[model samples]
Target: MPKNSIQFQKSFSIPEFIQMYGTEMQCRERLFHLRWKNGYVCPDCGSKSYCELKSRPLYQ
Candidate 1:
């Protein structure tokens, strides 16, 4: 190890991480893919389902 350097000798799980940070960028990417994976789209027909109240990390 060196100064100001970090290391990890293990693998990482993306799904586990998404569960941990759903409101994070990583989760947002997964959510976008998951939503479109099944070919589902929201036309924003006033249901407010696509509404994002803030600057979310994954909403384009």
Candidate 2:
């Protein structure tokens, strides 16, 4: 790390973060996975869901 460089620190609780920014489901999903870590079943419908979202960014 450089002395002149700055690093931003996260200053919010998990729940607060979810509420502050994120799609409705995004936060819940993240929390669900974090809590479970090992594995977790769907709360709404007892179905197994993927932990990660399938996405790819095209950088210029």
Candidate 3:
């Protein structure tokens, strides 16, 4: 491997991961950001505006 090669490792613990994404909303938000790094954008209509369902991890 090259000197500049990157190393992959599991640095975070389960508790830490849960702390960051312990709830449905938290998990959804994290996934949203990962999928849309710039911001939230509608996949169906291509709109930037959206509303979250109160009882579920869904966007409308």
Provide C-alpha RMSD values for all models, in order: 11.7, 14.5, 4.2
Top of the candidates by TM-score: 3
Taking the tens digit of each residue's C-alpha lDDT, what string does model 2 give over 14-59? 8887675568567666766677787766666766664554574211
Better of 2 and 3 by lDDT: 3
TM-score of each: 0.29, 0.33, 0.56
Poorest stretch of ten by lDDT in candidate 2: 51-60
Better of 1 and 2 by lDDT: 2
Model 3 scores a TM of: 0.56
Give the per-residue lDDT of model 1 (tens digit) for 1-60.
455434555646987765756576666667677777754356554232454456643332
Q: How accurate is candidate 3 locally (lDDT)?
A: 0.83
Better of 2 and 3 by TM-score: 3
**Model 3: CA > 4 A from native:** 1-8, 43-45, 52-60
Q: What lDDT does candidate 2 reach at residue 38?
A: 72
* Reference-based lDDT, each prediction: 0.57, 0.61, 0.83
Quote the RMSD, in angstroms, for model 2: 14.5
